[model samples]
Target chain A: MRSDAVLNEAVRGPSGPRKHRMLPSWVATTALLLPTYAWLTLAVLLPLLTMFVFSFMSATPMGKAPITFTLKHYRAFIDQPYLLNIGWTSLVIGFWTTLLCAIFGFLAAVALARATVGRMRETLLILILLPFWTNGLVRVFSWTMVLRENGFLDNVLHMVSADTGSISFLYTRYAIVLGLVHGYLPYMILTCYIALVTIDDAIIEAAASLGARWWTILFRILIPMAAPGLISGAVLTFVPVIGSFMEPRILGGKVGVTMGTVIEDQFTQAFNWPLGAALSFTLLAVVLAIFATFSGVLRRGAAA
Target chain B: MNNITRRNTLQLMSAGLIAGAGYSMFPRKAAAAGTITVLNWQGYGTDEAWSIKAFQESTGIEVVHDYYSSEAEMLTKLRTNPGAYDLVVLNAARCAQAMAEDLIAPIDYSKVPNISSVAENLRANENFNKDGKGYAVPWVWGLTALAMREGLPKADSYAVLGDPAYKNRVALQDDAVGVIAAAALLTGQDMNNPKDLDLVKETLKGFKPNVKLLWSTEDQWNKSFAAKEFDVAMYWSGGSVRSKRVSKLPVDFVVPKEGGIGWVDGLGIPASAPNAEGAHAFANWMIDPKFYVEWATKAGAPASSNVAAMEALPADDLSRQIHKPEYIATMSIMSALPDDRREAFNNLWQEVKAFYAE
Candidate 1:
């Protein structure tokens, strides 16, 4: 409270160091944060609680079936060994998608922050974000037109050389990862750009004046400064990528069954809501664990 | 004059944001009265077919169309939100389940005299009728058949889907019932209750090498087919006809020699419908021979039950494609599955999908 008053004095000018004339600090803080906390409670916390309760049920309480509490839903992975494999597939997709997005997005952010300026940089940022405006399903479907056999990519390859064989990569894991990266690249870029743009150019110039090479300045200054953006972007990408079934279903085809798709089947096709809820909680645990592990770096980055 | 300070830019942005939010916050008008909402499948709505516009113009009741992708989705929506929808188009297998759950009310035949134009065989079908009581009125019926590019070898058998020659060139339906039934039919087992679970598993496993994709929604399959992603697929009978006709593609749909899975999608009123009168009127108007003729001709769905509609169809290539005898004879209709067996099939499908052929 003392620090906040000092900060307020700094902002309001020292000439009129006005006496604290507001409500108690705690009351003011609660009043300011009430709406946000209420929104989170209603939207996120309530649904999560409902899902946890449903996870313990024997059957969906719909139709003629009587609902009973059971642990069998949690034992789904053990009951069906294939779920383990699907979980592993989801992990693999999450890993590759995050890695690729970080690399591509960080480089794009660097170029936008350092190499471009003004209108050009603004236009490029808009272009990067344009995909997010369109429906994700439609964008994923469009990838099929480019990657399928005799598709646009194949035709382009053939045009370069008549003897080129089919280069169709659709219905493959590689295509799934590619589509995911395309879908999430803008987010990573945006976060990284925000971090990078705030970086002081004088710091790099000072390093160069001290006989530091381009690589040294980049490794020592740019990357460390941008770490927060990269980490946050990766967390955002990895969490959703693990929960995505549509991209894998459309692009990966027969090979696309992952933990996300399995959970979806339980609710939509199998009508096994309890099992789906259990699987969802398991995924949530994994996501929370990831965030927990990175909490330190995230806190430091956020402060930066 | 052009020195725009950070504070000035922030003020401008805030002003723009306020205008945008204020515009959206304005109160919108309520829905007009006498409006009846119908929830149906994607392509079945009047916006796609345009024939249903005639009914709306003739009757004063306004028709609002919504769409549900699957039977489970339809059931969930109807169960959770009573009185939300006046009419719904549900599959035969689901119609029986819906009636038992009291999600839908039994049809009052007196209110819909167009039932007379529908064939007796269709009205008495097990899906919509229980103890001589009709629930949903059957509208469109089709077989899940094999659709291959015209020049490809005639895929008259399900075995062709697993043939090494067509490896990485075939797509199957992604649903548990459709894939399991197809596997059962191929193995010469009863589709509804196959005694040989191991053989069914083996049949689906054997198909892994040939299967390139498993498409779930009609939109998924149609887009993939239009892009020529696969040479052959387990095609939705009505969807295949529509796509082939629209694209002028030389794709032929034939009932596989192993027989085909069949389904009948029709209209029914929700038990808690707010506008039951409007719902019945809309249902009867849609099934009338006069409107069904246009639906059959324009929608590219077979009007098997509407006798007059069938006769009115042009005796042309399009009509022949729409109406096929084998769609009925070899058709294995889907029935409600016992819970344990349903779970078994779902698990088996997951295993089959995860299977990798060496």
Candidate 2:
């Protein structure tokens, strides 16, 4: 309460502080903040705070947490190398997902915007978004069925092998990439779509009338124009995908470990909240850094 | 939040805790009783509606249950302005923490009339009840057993998973405990002895090279396997049994002659539970023989702790899902161990994985 008054005074000026005069306003206007603050506090702040507190506290003898405060958990998190490896894996997953999403999204957006068709254009665009209607879990589950050993892909391989000689597929890092691409590929497409949809068809037609080759226009104007959306979509997809536990948990099988799994295990099974929190925050920091970097890149790309 | 900000908040909590009676501020139960909210990790308790539905129908309590994928999430909700949940179900080790932190209240058994009906061994189980008096009640317990395609069956054990012939055809449960334990058992390291990092590593190295994939859930994994995904894998003993029955596959499970890890989950009342009476009613209702029997009949994991509950189960399922009482007594249950030991296993397990994943 006192801090609130002080903040108000700092903004409004001390002269009319008591009167609450027409001085300055809040950093975020109240109407704007009501929803935003609630969202952040509930979804982000409180969870992060709890993770931080649990990090300081000792894990119960069962390797979880006790209310008792201790630094032993932080020490444990720092000391372990296996958990550290998970951080590296998380980065790899995030980077690759973003890169892939950017490529596929860019190409799809190009086709959607420039390709001339009446009903077909709208229909093709709608088809691209059809996967979004399904829940994320459903999409991931579908992939598991398709890729599991002796699953559709594996059976296909086996069928081919029966005719030829050998076969295998499923639950490899390759399986994980297939899942990641499936999961975030839509975000990329959506982002790139926004950029492409905004462009006037005349600009491309005008460039084409000047006798520019199709590939030349895509490389020069269309790509530069849509680069912002492509990067923005990559940012959206990559930032969270970096910390994703599910795609890997379900598809990576035993072969995958990302920081998300490590942080999760620390809190749930390991009972070392501090270490989990520390690890979580470590992952959080990495995500934020990338998020910031991407935001910077997109801003500059928009300008460029 | 930034590190400094997080540190300040934790410092405040720690200072506040020390200044008061060292327990967390358990939210007082509500007076007039609105909805009794229950939060649980996903896939816990009886399958979908099993844990809460019975309580709602029988007691006329309007219960709202939310599922979380992690305990940190549940703890986050409780720690920051708790008053949302009336009761929570957590493992025994967590019950001790919650109780000490004052995040949970000791279960007043007198209020829960049906508690004594819980099986005798579980009543005094180390994780659920710190004292003989109840604070948390055991929900479901089973050993970490391996399941395999039964068509090529001989007497089965963990060693079958390591057989080079089965390499890339076998799957293991993709969890730290199951992975480490399976590896340790094959290596002849004590499952209970979480220390012996080197042996665990060596054992997991042997097992990992043979393992095809690790699984996190029964739903997709089983469907894939039923459709001939991975030939065999480590599975929840109960689920594996159910899967075999439903798939009508030649799938069989071994308690593992070398040994297996046993796990148990308990339901506890959070200190901040909004409806103590309702929560008690719910907990009591959850453990009933009738309830346990339904879960066992449909779910395959029999609640053997309750003799009456066991009686309610089909005679054949009792023979199959849970072994005989004498065998149950000898069965080793998975316990929460200290970090150094657990991490030691995690480190070794990761090494083995890196080798195999390579």
State each candidate's clash count: 1, 14
Question: How does the DockQ of candidate 2 come out?
Answer: 0.18
Clash pairs, candidate 1, are B156-B257
Taken over the whole model, the C-alpha lDDT of each candidate is 0.78, 0.65
Writing each residue's lDDT as its tens digit, candidate 1 over B79-170 gives 99898999998778788889888889888989888878776656677879777788888776666768898888787788888999998789
Instruction: List all candidate RMSDs to the true structure.
Output: 11.5, 13.9
**Lowest-scoring 10 consecutive residues by lDDT in candidate 2 chain A?**
A58-67
lDDT tens per residue, model 2, A93-138:
7788778878887888777776747898879878988877899888
C-alpha positional error of residue A72 in candidate 2 after TM-score superposition, expressed in Å: 6.6
lDDT of 1: 0.78
Docking class of 1: acceptable
User: For model 1, what is the alpha-carbon lDDT of residue A212?
Assistant: 99
Proportion of native contacts found in each model? 0.56, 0.39
